[model samples]
Target: MTDDQAYAGTAEGQGPVQIDEELARHLDNKRTELFEEFEIRDTFPDDVLIEAKNATQDPEADIEEELESGDRVDCRDLTTCTIDPVDAQDFDDAISIERLDDGRYHLWVHIADVTHYVHPGSEMWEEAVKRGNTVYLPAYTIHMLPPVLAETVCSLVPNEDRLAHTVEMKIDPETLSYEEIDIYKSVIHSDERLTYKQAEKRLDDETAELHDELTLVHELADKLHEQRKEDGSLVLNPARDRAHTIIEECMLKANKAVTHELQWVRGLEAMFRVHPQPTPQEWDKALREIQELDGVSIPGDAWDDPRKAVNATLEQAPGRQLNKIQWAVMKVMPRAKYMSDPFGGHHALNFEIYGHFTSPIRRLSDLVNHWIIYQNEGPEDHDLAELCDHASARQKAGETCERLYKQFLQEVGLDPHAVNARGLEVVEDEEDAELTEEEADTESAELDL
Candidate 1:
């Protein structure tokens, strides 16, 4: 082929029509180089693939039968709304707002009733428990539920009926505080599904007829957001993480102090993913940095308290280095894992109770919480040693899978010559330049760890 013809006329690599019999052969090959090169799906034999997903299965027949029968028990016909990302499939949280007669308001956080779908001891529940958490890969999602349960059954699809358990908190608009709260078993049909981007836009746009309730709901959430910030919450400024959502921080931040009541208490054991406080060495460095910058010293010991000294440090020295010190201290703390004891919650939230009740269809904790709440009136079993152990194992497995997938992305994303690793191309500031190109390259190439 000539230079232009190379990419043109359905010949070699031109005009996107690079296909030929040999090219097609490799491109369609699922298991080998073709799939890896063309970004096709993973290929394993049927039985092997089934074994890979050996964890996922449908709920027991009896449970589904009960749910089918309970279909008649629909909830208030009032309009409900599902708020999530535009591309979100696991629609687990819905919201409703009620204006009270005496100027108070009720904000309802309705989570998907996964227990009604994946009952305890059922195959689906077993799979979900074994998976521990949904794998949110960039290219695809490894879900805890089949599409039936995730996108259809439990999803709060707009205008479609869905089962849910609602947590309604009475709020004083002036104080932005929950006066009293009530949790209920209810069925709801969403009137609309709004993305955060869209919802915020509606609130910002003057010409749009924004719902009074949505305005109030955002107002309340903003107030809550502001209050928490003022309280010295460990606000993250992501360094090396995805730009979209900074999803990890976003979820944790969004749910902060939102559902403390549902968090396990009094030995109703759970997996509390806690982080231990920073070590003395790190704290000493933090103290030094604070003294150097702000002429102040933070009490490192305060980090061990259930109430984190994050706010104190923020008040005294809220610089990047101080934030790193707090993060280091936060890292030193034990990682929160599944446990049966009612341990204190995250120090940053300053709430004794809390749990991940938002995404049941995607998290084992949410599923377990759903199970626990279903039997909320049942006799207490404060600790769940065996359950917690199993949960931790499953969590480790999920993490392994997710990390491997990200590594795979890096492998694919890198230049063919540099496929084995990634590195930064640092452009040091001119004023701070202290190294020649050779020195910089040598230093950058050194593996610190």
Candidate 2:
């Protein structure tokens, strides 16, 4: 049965009942019950634990050696910084901006070099591959890599000389045109770590430390945003805050730059983060639903030119209804995923080619991209299609786990002690099932809703 139908029980020969308080309570109860009953993989297996321990052993020595021998660019003098959540432990990406003598903007994006430590075919790599990505819970996180590696050695903390896969792009300050792209290994020292809350203050405050750099980054991002709009990119603001835009734009540029370099310059076999174009039928259905449900008038050519249509619809929508409409549209859309064939491109970003080269500490695809970018080892030996499929499945699982955990929190208010003690037991039946191919497929299909 569909989730809606299963949750809000249907009368004989009737459709799913409309949401009411009773339905809400009933759903909440069911979620709590499921939280207790569901076969949740809360922790790593003993084998994984042993493997992670081995991988993290002698981390200090490993890091020091890599720093000495690895390709390095001294970007310590650059006004680089990290913007993330206040409670974030691992700062995986950092950004810096400078005006070149030619009046073009030099934007530098440095991503944590997790692959430098987690070598191919190593125990940590195996663990990362199995977990796929970090499962971020509201209260805790199940990291893909052990904390020794993900939280410390590879984290781009301030003032630390960390190995990084760097993307340096020179863009015209006037035209916002990307003039040159350079991808290489580098060592960077972050000057500051600003949370989104702190970053919002720097928007117009000229006296802010690194104010000039922040302003340049913001302006470059704004220009790049306008350029993306011109390219017919579908702009979806999941986080509406302006401060978030600075980080988002920088990361997008880095990912896009890496993908473009791999596809055109290196000619290496690589995996990409691709978003297929929404089918005309899917677009039409979403618009029809919005019109019928909210009585909002969407542009007639929304399906033909989605970027314009969506913006116009949002403009017409009331501020409160904006999120509702966006959510509805997103529900009907296909999920973005990883792929071996870089030619698929990313329709949502309006990029001719795109890949996830940042956040290797969290994502396996990014780690693979780093390997291809730095080590010149393509994912050719691995079954690209299978790897992509596994990564996508793991990502979906993480999302599902997180969603369910949120529901649990809503049902039972924030009492950390109670929540922690409640479901500490592992399901004996499922504990041995370490996300095999068949199991992943079944779980992913179940959570596809």
Candidate 3:
């Protein structure tokens, strides 16, 4: 599910709500029930955790070895920065951009090289395949990889040299198309980390550290976003801010570049995202429903393309009706799935070829693609189609679990958005504090797999 769909009516940046012990227990029980119903694994196996701990033991020595062996490119000199949510734990991606003398743009997207640590024949790899992707609940997260590994070595923390899979693109100034693309392994040092709010501030303040770079990138990202809308791409979130636009456009460009290399240049099979278009009748039904909404109108010029029509309506629709408009479109839209062939293009993104590459830490498809690109070989013993099906199923299950969990929170008179933003604080009586601590310890021990 998209962010707008998952968090439709929730306000952002709310403070944490204090809950009594009784309510906290109720929330915990509901989460346990949902996990069982969806078959979501909440704990890592002992072997996987042990392997992750061992892998992160000597990071400095490993970097020196990799650099000395000439297997990785040296990019620590570049000015790189990561932009994520304020509460983000593990930073998986970062970006750096520059304006060239020829009026073109040079963009570098660096993603954590997760395949270097978790590959085939490893316990962590097996567990990651079983999980498929990270399951995110309100104020909670079930990581695909062990946190000891993902949060330490694989995280792109600031002021640290870390291994990365970098996509370097030289984009045309006029067309916003890639003039040159290069994908390679590198070691990078992030100069700083900025939250989404901080990034917006940088864009407004000319005296900020990364003000120039952010300004240049936002210009390119805005143009790219406009180009996507013009080419019939469906954008559900019309109010997305400049920080989000910069990140979204850059990641889409990098993912497209990697998949284009895999299919057209290398002639190999990888997990491609294929979103089937809704039937013509279904599109008509959605349009009719949207038109009936008060104060909403679809321009006549965009009627030929349903995606464009929705985009146009959303831009002009009232803020209160945004959720309804999105639901109208989503009800008729087909769920996108992964496939070994890139023949069926993604209907929503309106890309001829698209796949995952920028988020290897949480997604199985991106992790598999990283391995394939690095080794230049497809999985010989594995069924690619089966993997694709498993990923799609698990993703659906995760989404369902999250939806149910959020509904339960609302039923209990707690704001899901508030809990998600500021987290929950369990308030206990003075006499029950010790007992509560004991019970929590017991529960922690039970969860340590």
TM-score-wise, the better of 1 and 2 is 2
Clashes of each: 15, 0, 0
RMSD (Å) of each candidate, 1 decimal: 11.7, 11.4, 7.4
Tens digits of lDDT, candidate 3, 1-449: 43212222322544355777888788889889998999999998899999998888988788888999999999998889988776676888999999999999999999999988999889998899899999888788999899976777989988888999999999999999899999999999998888787788889988888899999999999999999999988888888889988988999999999998999899988888888989999999999999999999999998999999999998998977777888888899888898988887888899987898988888999999999898887655668888889998998999899989977877776666556656776767633321111111010000000
Q: Candidate 2 — which residues are off by over 4 angstroms?
A: 1-41, 44-70, 292-295, 299-303, 379-381, 414-449
Compare the candidates by TM-score and give the number of the best one: 3
State every prediction's TM-score relative to the real structure: 0.64, 0.79, 0.92
Scored by lDDT, the top model is: 3
Task: Tell me the tens digit of each residue's lDDT in model 2 across 177-229.
Answer: 57999887887888777767667777767877877888778888877776776
Query: Candidate 1: which stretches are off by over 4 Å?
Result: 1-76, 209-211, 237-275, 279-281, 284-333, 377-383, 414-449
The candidate 2 region of ten consecutive residues with least summed lDDT is 440-449
lDDT of 1 at 388: 66
Candidate 3 stretches with Cα past 4 Å from truth are: 1-15, 430-449
- For model 1, residues 188-264, the per-residue Cα lDDT tens digits are 77877765555655566666533565676665655554565555444433222121222222234324333354452
